[model samples]
Target chain A: MRLPRVEDIEKRIPRPEDFTARSRGPATTARVGTALGIAFGICFLTGLWSHFQYSSPGWLPIGPNPAWLYRVTQGTHVATGIASVPLLLVKLWSVYPRFFLRPPKARRDQLLDVLERASIGVLVAAAIFQLTSGLLNIVQWYPWEFSFRRTHEAVAWVAIGALLVHIAVKLPVIREGLGASVEDETPVHSDGPSRRAVLRGVTVASGLALVLTVGQTVPFLRKVSVFGVRDGGGPQDLPVNRTARAAGATRAASDPAFVLQLKAGGRSMSLTRDELAKLPQRTHRLPIACVEGWSRNAVWTGVAVQDLIALVGAPSGSTVIVRSMQTRGAFRTSELPGDFVDDPRTLLALELNGEPLSLDHGYPCRIIAPNRPGVLQTKWVRELEVRT
Target chain B: MRLVRGLLLLTGLGFGLWGVWLMRDFTSEQLVSMGTFLAGGVLLHDAVIAPVTVLLGVVAARLLPGRTRSVAAIAFLVWATLTVAFVNVLSGQGGKPDNDTVLHRPYGLSWVVMTALIAAIAATVAYRRRRIAGPPRSR
Candidate 1:
């Protein structure tokens, strides 16, 4: 089938000015664009940090101290992303009128117009993908087969690139749009909502969105953040993302014969659950900060990672490869960076909040390290291999 | 300004192309599926969401009485916010096995309370505005 010409498409589609409820205009778009620009910038930077933390190169050293650094950055990343949802909607709506604008008649101008539209299509598609998929990820819902991390990072590059291009192309219009007050723009419908009212509504909507969901990261807002997926409350007042049964580690973890093995300097030593408890138990209060952004601090009681390394005659700054009892999963085995292993607070935790660990909370033993993502803190840990 | 714009455009193009290149490892099926999702998102927002929002705004503007329109709009926004916020809960997908604390709060009650509070505030503001204006003009 032959596609319709631009003129024919324009003829069928209603012009933005013709819509009775069209109160948004260039000024509104610019204002919303500014807000979105800031939000996207923050989200991008934080996202980059998170990605680097997950896939750090040997030369890139993420400091071990300031245990809350990753927590705040990842939290900001998710919060800004969620807040951008409303801003993006309003910004897109404000500019929706341009979709029906007649293409330029001049050959060069027409080519430029086509190029601009194509860029916009890319930008819009990428932005929507990043936001929606991000929200799904936080909720632990994967509807697609592609890896979320790689796809998200790749799409982020596309979105930001398109955003910069759009801004560059629209620079003149943006300046003009923002120069005048929003009220100066004439409303298409005199009896409809005023531009000021629309602005107010947008602000309210965006604020509500932020307030309703940000409590997952901001502890004070927990009660009001009804949309927060993680309530910051679980066994020992710490939320559990994956249970032992869910990870297929229940049987392996709870087996009476379960013994945690440590290998370092070609010497292997195994400790039973009771023997682990008999070892000098230390308590450290650290937060289990998940990449999804919810975090809660708990008093974790167990043996220090350094002490475990020392038991096997390993060097002071040796990296440890932690293997979990789970038969299969992406994070069933994790490597603790040398810095994390050396940190005094890093523990192979046996209890939480002064009680024995619950089955869902890595019952027998788990790795808990400072400034580390929750996924890296391997649960139901069964083996530790040291690398000098 | 022109130089900056040019630089930005070129940089943007470079990043976009690199992003596309990175997806070379993805299977054709995955690419097609992801493309569909991306396009569907844009269409959903532009076609369904924007039009519905405009229609609601128009209906509220033309039909509702003075001051009540603002109240209605605020009420509608609050309702929409609550709905979007609790979508998973409403759809019964928020719960997890052996984990009551995840999405455990009474979201329906919270929405009601929150909406009522918003409506109450809007009414109060409207009442105060009327009081300040001395009364509605005898139209």
Candidate 2:
């Protein structure tokens, strides 16, 4: 095959204006870019926060103080991601003509143009991965075999980085484009909608996306959010992500010998289901927030974690590890920070919504802490080990 | 500005390379699957979603009357895009066990109601505009 010369290639490629109904220009691109920039920024920051909460590095102490911190952040992460779907589509549409633009003739400009196109490819690919995987994750659906957490987090860095680079490169054009009025002398396709009309359509589309889906996180809008994955309704008006049967804890959870064991300060204690109920119980109207961006505020009644630690003669503020009865899964054991151990609201929850905890809802015993991720809540808890 | 752009470009390239390096730990099959997903995502958006949207818009512009063209197109686009994005949830594929809370609503009916509401609002706006203009001007 004879290789085509650069000039020949340039001659063969069509200009952006040749095929489109309107003159594809920088104005719409800048407008859409601004919206996408904000959305991507929110998604990246919130996603990073969610990642940190799981990893819990030593330097960045993720305190359980705010009580609703993870709930709000993770919810915002998923919501922003969902909102980006329309924005991204519009953004890509606005720039679709650029893909067909004739390559620059100058050697320097050609190299730069190639670099710019490559960066865009990376940005688009990473953005799609992040959004699709995230949406799938919220619905508890995994189409790919790769671990969602690592891949999602890793690609997020790629997306945000490419986004920053894109912003940097396009800053001048963006400034000029935005400065021009929406109705300014941008060429339009004789048959197509005006720029203002297109903008209006995009705005309506974005708003519709938010309104239809945000109710998964926002309490008031739950009724209207038909597309919401989590409707905040479950066994006791709270949704369950992992069921007892799914976790393979049904047998052990229902066994009469099932007792919550505590070991701390060289002392050990065991309490039956009935005995646990007799302890001083407090009620908390805290929300069970999941990392998947659904949450419900339910009345949880149980003994404070502090009180439970005291039963084994452990000092207050001691770090404790809660173990679930499920013999399998990564979250079978979870460590509570010293501060969380000291928080009075942190509980060994025995009841949810005024009823005994359903087996799938972590019956017998479970840990409920303020501002903790749902996975860290550690349902079907059987053992508590206090760490020095 | 030039310096900032250069610095950002370098940083972005660095981060992207690091991400690629991280993927080295995965098996070749996982890497290949990841690549397929990444490429498929771009293709889906570019080849299917954007083109379809543009085609729909063009058809609507050509077919719909002038006064209602923009309004109808906007409403239709909103509803259609949402339906596609939410097909899994709408079709009850998101349902799990006895948990009626996860994707429990009648999405098809809700979409109808929402579309009806949008149409009503658009009609009202058009009617008011017509009234304010004191009927269509003589051609």
Candidate 3:
């Protein structure tokens, strides 16, 4: 008897399992990547604008509120870049299986399939390098010999270009995907979470990372946040004693003590130059490697970054990035590798060669590292980012 | 391929451990001396290689006409490859670099060149399609 065949029975089943497998496709990753790419665009444009402002001063279009605009924009640029990390990671994971597919069902489909796969690969690689390198720069780590500062600037251009192509190529599919109502093609899956559910998870995770990262950098909540305070204390990277003495021995002689303000953990706490001198001091010799092709080792006397972070009630994390203040006018920041941040010996120095810091020598404060570039050891630091 | 992947993983692990070992062996004072050489590598790559590659790709893209798309794709491959190579060189990672250089070097640069090339190519393609659609002009 032609009692309803398996096909007929399957039609009536209305299974959720069908949707699960089908949902894992190029479009999913493309959508996720597209969102991240747009975010990347915002960060790139903001960073570039900030770079111009720093380099040329007044070249950037100044909005109505000129005073706080640079700070806000640069802050946003960094925040968004850190935030994009998880989004990029999830997007890549989503599209990884697509790389193994056979020829597409149609010729046009095949062309698109290849383009989608290629773009995803490039995007993932670029995103990883940029994010990792940028993260390292903040921590004052330069494990790789290639100029992180130059490489960062260069790769940024490349990432932007790839992102544009990725957008252009996927525009049609994106339109189609957006056009389809969620209810219309909802398929059911047996073994795994639905695509919608996975996407929601990704969004939540990325959001959490962003919130934590942003929270660490902002001045209002920084003092109490777990990331820890920067205290602008570190080994002076340059020869401040010689410089100050060379400028005028009399001025050096008159100054009984070098004064440096200790501000760390997003202005959670502050210690004036006089205050820092009153505290029992600690000195350590350290190396300063700069991506700009120079290195200096000097005795640094000041407080440890971790100690300051602890004092301000900031949480010391597994990773932290230090922004150097040496190139104040240029958007020049170096990364301290994650391992060094974990080290107990790292310091933010107040003095070099038994004298207080000089202006050219990252006066008031500079990072002194067991192994870190001078660029990563920021001078006049105003903020620090710590990630657990 | 799995064996190769395994080998690569082992090599990477070895290098990382080696770096940690070196750090542990050297006193903080000696690290400064090591940093001097390390910083030179960072500077050379950042200042010279990165900017040169970008400039080279831009010039190449301009010269190649319709071939710009392919060249742009090739350029990114070149850039990423060079980066990895230079990084390894500075880190003093042993063994010759893999031929996957073709794939790795160009990833970043390809996107830039390809985007410009594709835009120009698409515009040219569209314009040609439009011209052909109209009646031929009299000679």
RMSD list, candidates in order = 3.0, 3.3, 23.7
| Candidate 2 ranges beyond 4 A from true positions | A1-14, A19-24, A186-188, B65-68, B115-139
DockQ of each: 0.48, 0.47, 0.01
Q: How many steric clashes between backbone atoms does each model show?
A: 0, 2, 51
The sequence of per-residue lDDT tens digits that candidate 1 reaches over residues B33-101 is 788889998898778877797688777767866656655665565456445534544445534566665
Off by over 4 Å in 3: A1-23, A26-31, A57-65, A104-118, A182-187, A223-388, B1-139
- Cα lDDT of model 2 by residue, A264-292, tens digit: 96799999989999999999988888888
lDDT of 3 by residue, A1-388 (tens): 7799877875764332322234455556656666787788887777666555433344443322222344456556665766675576556545444433555689899887886666555544555666656654543345565554444555566556556555555565666765554332454332233456445555654554454334323545432322211212233323121122222223422344643323334545555566666666778765443322223346778866676656655554434555533322343344444445445566667787788865556566666666332334566543444533
Q: Is candidate 2 or candidate 3 better by TM-score?
A: 2
* Residues A1-388 of candidate 1: C-alpha lDDT, one tens digit per residue: 8899987876887775666543567777888899998899898889989888886777888857798888889988887887777678767867877787877899999999999999999999999899888877776777787888888988898999999999999999889878868674554344445566667777887788788878887889988788778778887778998888778999998898999999986799999999999999999988888888777778999999989989989976888999998876689899888888888799999999999998889979999887888888899999999976
Could you tell me which residue pairs clash in candidate 2?
A21-A189, A22-A189
- Is 1 or 3 the stronger prediction by lDDT? 1
Candidate 1: stretches off by over 4 Å: A1-12, A20-23, A185-188, B66-90, B123-139
Q: Rank order by lDDT, top first?
A: 1, 2, 3
Clashing pairs in 1: none
**Highest-TM-score candidate:** 1
TM-score rank order: 1, 2, 3
For candidate 1, the docking band is acceptable
